[model samples]
Target chain A: MGGGITLEHFLVLGLILFLLGAYCVLTRRNAIGILLGIELMLNAANINYLAFAFFGGARYDGQIFAIFVIMLAAAEAVIGLAVILAIYQNLRTIDVDATETLSG
Target chain B: MLNSLAAQAIFYVIAALTVGFAALVAFSRNIVYSAFALVGALMGVAGVYILLAADFVAMVQVLLYVGGIVVLTIFAVMLTQGIGDLAVSNRAVGPGAGLAVVALAGAVMLYATLRTPWHLATAVAVASTTYGIGNAFLGVYVLPFEIASLVLLAALVGAVTISRQDTPPPADGAAEKGRS
Candidate 1:
């Protein structure tokens, strides 16, 4: 309170978000759920990047990197959802647990 | 100062919105709920970007992540049938193990975050970053910028290719028999 908001505050917040995202990825059976988790994790990383950029000199590098991450995330979501739709077309279910053809 | 206090309050509110909705996204039983909760979590992150003075990134977050990705997720959730069964649709596996892993990772990350001696400098004065970002994208980051556009084009084409339904079999008895 005395120092107002510190870097640690943002760092801790990002950490919590990352952990929750990890939990989501680890526990969820649906592929889309896992994708949701991934989005959260990516955002958590972006938070850390912006936080550092803000506190470490306010350079544009971190912001640029965050934008790239967001772009890649958009790509990933499109590809991932398309794959899920493909799986659904063939198997009729989007359950991650059910799609184990590669497990063999 | 009163200004700092107000900033702190705003930060707290943004943090609460982010973490609370993230929790809902992680733990909600319905995939639809999780997808929708992600909207809140993402918006909260955009707020955090604003708080960090990244106006351009914040707007991009709203435009891309919230506007595009969340809607795409919701559409995916609806397209897949059997969404009404809340119990099995978004079932979680090994919650006990997941909790253990999260705790371990959280503890490690928290310890590292608290113990690290971060080199901090006085933050730059808040200003419009759109100009600086545009310049950087065209100048020092030009190569990567081009590469990103390539990636997006590839992804766009790949998504269409992958999701396109197989051409309906020719409306012929022989074609229908072969498809079956």
Candidate 2:
């Protein structure tokens, strides 16, 4: 471990993670998988906040927003899961492809 | 040279893990595996935060994302299905276009970075991320915090109402015949 690190390292890592999350969002069929993708996307934003805070002048402001993002993610998970449960109750299957019942 | 060597090694390890786990989460077909991959990716992100001297935010990343959100996702996957879906893995989307777009975007960023002359003074970047975060929690961010709490409250109530299924009463009035 180094005594200290630099900004480039953090930025590169954030980029890679953000791309991965984006890929997941584009391809996942499971509603929960989509939610996980959203989680990654939000996390990528969090990384940006921390990086800006450390390297730029946006310190506390970034962390506070990141904290709110995390809280919002948790809330999203709860509501998403509830919605998923309701879908399961109606269709008996969790596949997103199968939820074409309301295509009209 | 030695100082940079250490930074380079730590950077590679954490960066590799973050990218690898994120790719896994994005590509893995089994929903549960994706959730688990999210845990790994989230931890790597926390590591990156720590590297940036944002120790408090890093801990929060571990606590809320890796610990809470990922675990919640796993429990949800378990609740909805049997063990069969665990084996049911398949690629659902074509990632080539997305990959191309990301690569192009990365190239643009790189070009922009190279085009600009960055400040190189040894600015003592002491990341007091926690102090700032604390101030926000008690200051301008209080309204958003309260609103988030309300959203959580609504989610809990909504979940309870949706999950609890009340039994329907006998439509033919079997209770009356039984009483007679």
Candidate 3:
């Protein structure tokens, strides 16, 4: 007579999402694609936060962390995209592999 | 019991939607498709938040993540030329090594999650968490909240400066310099 959904279920989902985001980060050449991967990883972290809040305690601490994470993700995306645009202006390419002006 | 069963079903559906679209985001060759697929994946995450009784977080996820961040990402993708063209290879390089590493990491995480003895709390009544969250933000977490806003302001200024510095000199500036 137990509830079917367990904490493990949610944690496993977060794990899967995190791994997928890692894969995206490792494989994609597009700078924006890498940014997308980072976003995925952040969302996975958010999932873990809410899941823990739901099952670990009666506190709203986890939800607060999730909100903070969302805000940070927005800031990161804004800065990352701005950097990408600047790189494009300098190099005229968005391919992470090809943008090597900094290598010197 | 029946209600619990129905909740379990919804949970599985949302989990599937989240993971499936996440896979699409990882594998799609078209960057636009991947960006759009991220929308579905993030929406699924929001749905899971609702299932966890976090109504406020879910709404914020949809509004900020799906509405703002994803749209900004799509615009960035479009602004960077040659990314949208299918001729450009969006294919994953070093496939074998990447897959192996992902598998190894995923397996470790799954094992850890399933094996950990999590301190499970009794299912308490789901109260209005939005109020509690807001109160905490304005009360105990006020310092962190203010710091977050400050960080955001700094990031805004930094982004504007970074973008502005790279822009080619305006015609007026160039003419002024020539006249000088």
Candidate 4:
């Protein structure tokens, strides 16, 4: 803990965040809750990308990919929320389990 | 030496903020609380980006992720009803199974991460990444940049099309019967 921050430290932090996100996604019944978990997972990945970029000769590629990921995440959030709204309109609930009409 | 120590302290604080709020987001019983807690988690990630010398990406993370997505999620939560029923509304299903799955995945990922012999580069002086990033986006990464814009446009149209109330909701029973 006294030593300066290292790549492993960032990697471990990301691992914890990713695992928490996985747990959130696996357990949450609410659709928005699942989306929130996905966001956390994506952030964890972004942290890894920036960490590698900083350490790997400080190239711009990692940051660029991170920007793209953020862009895609925004698109995903928009579409997902819209779908959730649509589901709520029809079923009056945003529970993932309750919207399992396609399971048949 | 003192400077590095201070940096380490700051890193620990930011790490705590990030992991702590993330835990809240994942485990909070109230859906609204989960949504709000996401702001803290995301902000802490931005702090992480800054620490990693990614100023532009950090700002973008703050702007897009914090300003855009979390607010949209909160809106979605408020728009839907039954939000007051905190106990059951944000219920967890199959906690034991979820824990088992996460633990297994965490173990594999942590093992790989720790065991890898990474090729490390000497630390370079921190510089503004905005100029280089802008050039790469316009020059080498132009195609992907254009494609991203197209994707955003498509998302805009699709969201409006899907969520608009003018269209009638699909007949659930009929759809299920048809599918079967």
Chain B TM-score of candidate number 1: 0.88
Stretches of candidate 2 above 4 Å error? A1-6, B1-4, B82-131, B166-180
Show where candidate 1 strays beyond 4 Å: B1-3, B85-93, B167-180
TM-scores for all predictions: 0.92, 0.80, 0.92, 0.91
Off by over 4 Å in 3: A1-3, B1-3, B85-93, B165-180
Tens digit of lDDT per residue, candidate 3, span B1-180? Answer: 114878889989999999999998987887888899999999999998888888999999999999999999999988888776343333545656778999998888888888888898877688778899999999999999999999999999999888765445677675655432
TM-score of chain A of each: 0.95, 0.88, 0.94, 0.95
Of candidate 4 chain B, the 10-residue stretch with the lowest lDDT total is B84-93
By TM-score, the candidates rank as 1, 3, 4, 2
Candidate 4 lDDT over B1-180, as tens digits, reads 213877889999999999999999998988899999999999999999999999999999999999999999999999998765353333445887888989999999999999999777878888899999999999999999999999999999999999987644467756545332
Model 2 Cα lDDT, one tens digit per residue, B47-113: 8777766788788888988888888888888888742454232254446666676677777765664
True lDDT of residue B86, candidate 1: 53
How would you encode candidate 1's per-residue C-alpha lDDT over A6-97 as one tens digit per residue?
Answer: 88999999999999999999988788899999999999999999999988985699999999999999999999999999988888888887
Q: For residues A12-51, could you state the per-residue lDDT of candidate 4 as single tens digits?
A: 9999999999888888878888999999999999999999
Checking candidate 2 for backbone clashes, the offending pairs are none
Better of 1 and 3 by TM-score: 1
Per-candidate DockQ vs. reference: 0.70, 0.50, 0.66, 0.64
Q: Between which residue pairs do clashes occur in model 3?
A: none
Docking class of 4: medium
Residue B54's C-alpha lDDT in candidate 3? 88
DockQ order, best first, reads 1, 3, 4, 2
lDDT of 2: 0.72
Q: Share of real interface contacts recovered by each model?
A: 0.80, 0.51, 0.70, 0.79
Q: Which ten-residue region of model 1 chain A has the weakest summed lDDT?
A: A1-10
